[model samples]
Target: MSNELYIEKNGAIATIVINRPQKKNAFTLAMFKELGALLDELETDKNVKVLVVRGVDETAFSAGADISEFLEVRFSAEKAKKYNDFALESIEKLYRFSKPTIALIQGLAIGGGLELASSCDFRFAAENSKLGITAANIGIVYNLTSTKRLYNLIGLSKTKELLYTAKLISANEGKEIGLIDYVYSSEEIEEKCFEFAKQIIQKSSVAISGMKKVIQSVVDGENEESEAISEIILASYCSDDYKEGIQAFMEKRKPNF
Candidate 1:
């Protein structure tokens, strides 16, 4: 994996840090490729129960794609298409990740940055964080998948307003509009993120994974009565975690999940 995108595992929680503080963690094409590869590995790594994505510092979650590389790397239609495809693959992986995912946003989360945050299952932003999708300002259309994710999170009206205006909203506004799940002061954001992750890790992994799959299916418009959904429900019922949970409740003890 590229140094720009590194992972730090702490027991059940794996934190993916976007390390480009000098550039406000702006993603390069290589960074996208690395992220896609890392997600592939983490998805199969049963030890990682929760994933948190964040920038290395409090300055910015990400300034989005590095525009300085535009002329050299994305000046031509063919090149731009390839570049976008790389990012799309990475974003899709994050969106479809089976494990619980969270985005810890601190400062600026604009354009692609906002897209990255939206890909996660939950977004927790610092009170002063600024988030927006600014592709409209640069005369480029946002990717369809990212747009759909944003629309799903904040609804059609708010999504349209953000895209059309290209204005960054405060973290509080983001929470109000459903772009973020929670907001904390900048100093407390990281600590609060870990606290949230701890709560998630304490849950049964089997149930969490099953829930993630079923939720994704529903979001994709699959009916709850589908056979695939039923199969997942059945598997969860048969899992050891389920029995353990029942035993713990009866015994009045915390379950070791």
Candidate 2:
């Protein structure tokens, strides 16, 4: 797609970089479709087992929906819905991606940026990064999909505090509230986060993907053992990864999976 948003692959790990550093990696309406299409492409790629989403540099992860486009794109209810659908598709895909995703934030992750980071399985932010949702500041209401993701990550009261205040929180504060999974120095964030992604890819992809689905089902209010969930749990026994795991244990070696 556009150079403004592109993917960089390294072995089993692939990263989608938000490249508009000048705009703090702000995403325009068109970039949303490009992002969704990239996710679609990556989903079918056998070689990619982990995805990392980040900005071009350590300045910012993203500023969220480019405010400059709001006049033309979200000036009315119908226009807003059309525009939001593009973003919803991309973020939802990232949320339910078959593989794992990590969002590495450095300077800023506010507005839709914070929401996008919240969608990832893991969020690693630099020590002094600024994060928040500023929809209130612009007189715009945050969409439910984005709101629910934040709510799931940080819970009800904290989510309300964030939305109501429109205040930026520190990385440490984010961790304390469960919004950030890891915090490191700006210099250490990338190295540590990518190392984390590498570690995950070394595990069994089959197990990881299955658990992702099960965990999401639970998040969506599935508490009981449904037949579909049971099937996923049972099907693992027949997967090649399971066979290799058993063989490796017997042979006292690490599994190739």
Candidate 3:
């Protein structure tokens, strides 16, 4: 993995830190590739039940994609499409991750960074943090997947306001607009994020994963199929963990599975 992204594991919780503090943790092509790899690892790593993503420094969750690299990489239309594709793959992995995910926003979360946070299941931000989608400023059209994610979180009206204005909004404003789930002081952001993650970890992993998929299905308009719900129920019933859960409950003990 590139040094641009760092992974720290703490039992059931895993934190992925964007390490390019000098560039406000802006993601480069290399960082995007590393992020995809990291997600792949986390998916199969049963020990990691919840994932938290944050920038290395409190200065910015990320200022967005590294524009410095974009100059050379996005010079041509074809190249720009390829570059965007790389980022799309990484972001989509996070969007569709089976486990519960959280975005810990400390500072500026702009452009693609804002999109990354939107992909997560929940976002927690420092009171001083700023969030915005700035694709309009760069003359790029937001893709369908990204637009859907943002619109789903904040609704079309608010999503358009942010995209059209390209203005940074306060953390509190973000929460009010439903962009972030909670806002805390800078001093308390990290503590609050961990506490949130701990609470999430206490829940059943199977149930969480199932709910994640079902929610996505609903958002994607696939939940109308009765088979979708049935599949989740059937999978849960046949899971070894489910059996263990029942045995544990009958035995009056915590599940060890």
Q: Name the TM-score of candidate 1.
A: 0.97
TM-score of every candidate relative to the true structure: 0.97, 0.98, 0.94
User: How would you encode candidate 3's per-residue C-alpha lDDT over 28-133 as one tens digit per residue?
Assistant: 8888888999999999998999999999889899998998887798878999999989999999999899999999999999988998899899999999999898
- lDDT digits (tens) for residues 129-247 of candidate 2: 99999999989888888888889889999999999999999999999999999999988999999999999999999999999989989899987978988999999999999999999
Q: Which candidate gets the maximum TM-score versus the true structure?
A: 2
lDDT order, best first, reads 2, 1, 3
In model 1, pairs of residues that clash are none
Weakest lDDT window of 10 consecutive positions for candidate 3: 221-230
Candidate 1 overall Cα lDDT vs. reference? Answer: 0.92
Q: What is the C-alpha RMSD of each candidate to the true structure, in Å?
A: 1.1, 0.9, 1.7
Cα lDDT computed for each candidate against the true fold: 0.92, 0.93, 0.90
What is the TM-score of candidate 2? 0.98
C-alpha lDDT of residue 177 in model 3 = 85
User: Residue by residue across 106-220, what tens digits does model 1's lDDT show?
Assistant: 9999988888899999999999899998988888988788888898899999999999999989999999999999999988988999999999999999999888888888899
What candidate 1 gets wrong by more than 4 Å, as runs, is none
